[model samples]
Target: MKKISKVFFITLFLVVIAVALGVAFPEKFETITGNIKSFVATSFGWYYMLLLSALVILAIFFAVSPYGRIRLGKDHERPDFSTASWVAMLFSAGMGIGLVFYGAAEPLFHYMSNAPLAEEGSNKAFKQGLSYAYFHWGLHVWAMYGVTALSLAFFQFRKDEPGLISSTLKPLFGDKMNGPLGVLIDVLAVFATVFGVATSLGFGAVQINGGLSHLFGFDVGFTSQFIIISIVTILFLISAWSGLSKGIKYLSNANMVLAVILLIVVLVVGPTLLILNMFTETFGLYFQHIIQMSFRTAPLEGDNRGWLDSWTIFYWAWWISWAPFVGMFIARISRGRTIRQFITGVLILPTLIVSIWFAAFGTTAGNVQNSGVDLTQYATELVLFNMFDQLPLSIVLSIVAILLIGSFFITSADSATFVLGMQSTNGSLEPPNTVKVVWGIAQSAVALILLYVGGLAAIQNTIIIAALPFSFVMILMVIALFRALNKEIR
Candidate 1:
């Protein structure tokens, strides 16, 4: 692993140098960026929708299989955290900045450009808008996390291989993983996670800064970003140092409470009737056209193709990029649950909650747009402050928004810190606290630097590029996980 890490860093340095040089020459960089985007757009295209749908089906099958009876840890032992605590961590880490950013924007985006299944400017817009948000937040996204957590719980906690991604692949590679092959997989997972979580950090910083600026009437700048990062780093470091039982357990529970309060407040104060109606219709649409929407790929020549690429493909790629962190975090919390229990906890319950959030929040935002309570002009700005102005109760809503963003950011950072600690210390079930603090601080520093450099878009693009290698690694992980499950059953 150390050797692989060295090689990876060296290669990364070279790539950074190349990119730096490219940046120095604007025309050259623009050409390169365009070519890369074109390739991704064309190759990934509509097929991603079908591919993601297949993955969701596979996860459902695994959830129901006999091997799902296998439990993590000792058969008789109780779990470390309460059910609520466990669920909160799973939801927070899995959802992260996504829920905050997409909560308003996704529905509004879809409302403007209706789904392929809906007529242009039809009444179906509101339903289809929420439907798309739920789809992105639902079973498929959580399933990615489920597979990762299940692999770790069974192999690391139960079977006693090290609690790292490479060890999870041991069922497929056996002794081969002890050498170069294993190190390579671990490197990919780590690098992917760093980039992915960093992207979340970037987004969280920007949004939080935006909210604070609006709430306090202060100017938004890198100073706000730096302050948020500093606070996040300190909080997560403290959490990491306290270890899972004391730190993570409490944080997750607090996060859930805050989330529920925000949700309930929005439900009561916003367009309650409109939200309920839209939610019911959206749920119906989601289930009614599940097959078609899930697998839809408009003809290459049609207008629907753009919408599919922007939303569906973007979502799949985002989930894939986030799989490592989410998987490892779930694995950490799922030590005493059966595979079926793990699946239900990681996939089913979280999806249901996320869908509800989108139903309530997204629908309210859409109603505001449709009813002209606000022009929805700010949604286009991609800044949370501007976006908040579109709603009626901007002040109260902004507070809830800040809490939601801060808690989720902390949730993700703390979990990543714990996972990185475990991975670095030879994958011990309870790695040393020092390791966690180190990684937590490192993540914050990276986030701060990314924020200072070019804000959210730069960080996101960097993460997407870093995630390219891990996309293949996750596919390999699925293969290895199934092989392990098959061997266990046999």
Candidate 2:
């Protein structure tokens, strides 16, 4: 483990140096990274749908198998959080700011552009809009997170392996993972998670800053972004240092309550009929076309292919990028759950919540757009803040929005801090609190730097790149997890 750790960190330090040099000498690095991203985009774009379908199939298999009965913790140990609180923590950490930022904008963007399933000049745009929103927020995305969590929880709590990515692979590699290979895996997981969470923090910070700027009429700039990151980092560090029992459990409960209240307000105060109709139709479309839509990779034969690449492929990659951090966090919280329960709770519940959000928020935005409410102007001018303006009781809506974003960001930050601390401490569940604090501060610094460099897009691109290695690692992990489960169950 010591040798592995040294090699992994040395490699990471080299990569960091390279990234720094690339930033300093953009003329060279830009060309290199651009080419790499383009290659990844094209290669992965070809089979994005197929990959997603396979993921869903795996999810279904895991949910129903006897292996699913295997719980995470010792036989006598009980879960720490109630089911409701557990689900809430999972949702808040998993969804982060994407639910808020994309809830309205994503549907509208698809409505104007038309999704793959929609006919040109068809009035079925709203249906397609909601469908695509759910597509982005639905099962496959959450399954990626579920796989990681289940792997970690099962290995760490059940097998007494350290709670790290490498330990999850032990069933495959056995003691081979115990030396340099294991350390390399753990380091890669940590690096991927840090970058992923930093990306979320960057997006959350920008959106929160934009929302505040709109409410208070302040100028939006890097300063506000930095301040938001700093404050959130501090709060999350405090929570993380306080440990999961007190800090994370309480914050997660509050987050869910706030989220539920916000959704109820939207349902009652917004366009009730439109929201209901859209929710039903969208869910119906999702179910009806589940198989077809899951595997619809647009052939590279026309201009329409660009749309699929931009949206669907990008979403898959984004989910992949987020898997390590979200997966690790879910694993940490799901110690006493069966595989079936874990998958259902993490994948299904989050999908339901995200679908409802899109239905309520997206339908309201769609109605406003079609009804000549001038929301398009706000959407175009100030995309983040405009969604709030369209809601009934705009002031209250803004407050909810702020709370939701803040809560989600803090939850993610806290989870990532805990995960990173565990990784650094050789997979100790009760890792040193000081290590957690340090990682929390490091994540904040990375977020602030990324914000200053090129804002959200830059952070996103970096995260996507960082995810490349971990994506392959995850495929191995899925195989290993199933093998371990089968061995244990039989």
Write down the lDDT that model 1 would get: 0.71
Reference-based lDDT, each prediction: 0.71, 0.76
**Model 1 over residues 17-58: C-alpha lDDT tens digits?**
544553465455445544574467557655556556767777
Q: Report residue 117 deviation for candidate 2 (angstroms).
A: 3.6
Off by over 4 Å in 1: 1-37, 113-121, 379-394, 452-454
Compare the candidates by TM-score and give the number of the best one. 2
lDDT of 2 by residue, 320-420 (tens): 77777778778888888777788888778888889998998888777777776655555322563576577668878877888788988888889888777
Candidate 2 has an lDDT of 0.76
Tell me how far the alpha carbon of residue 353 in candidate 2 is from the true structure, in angstroms, after superposition. 1.1
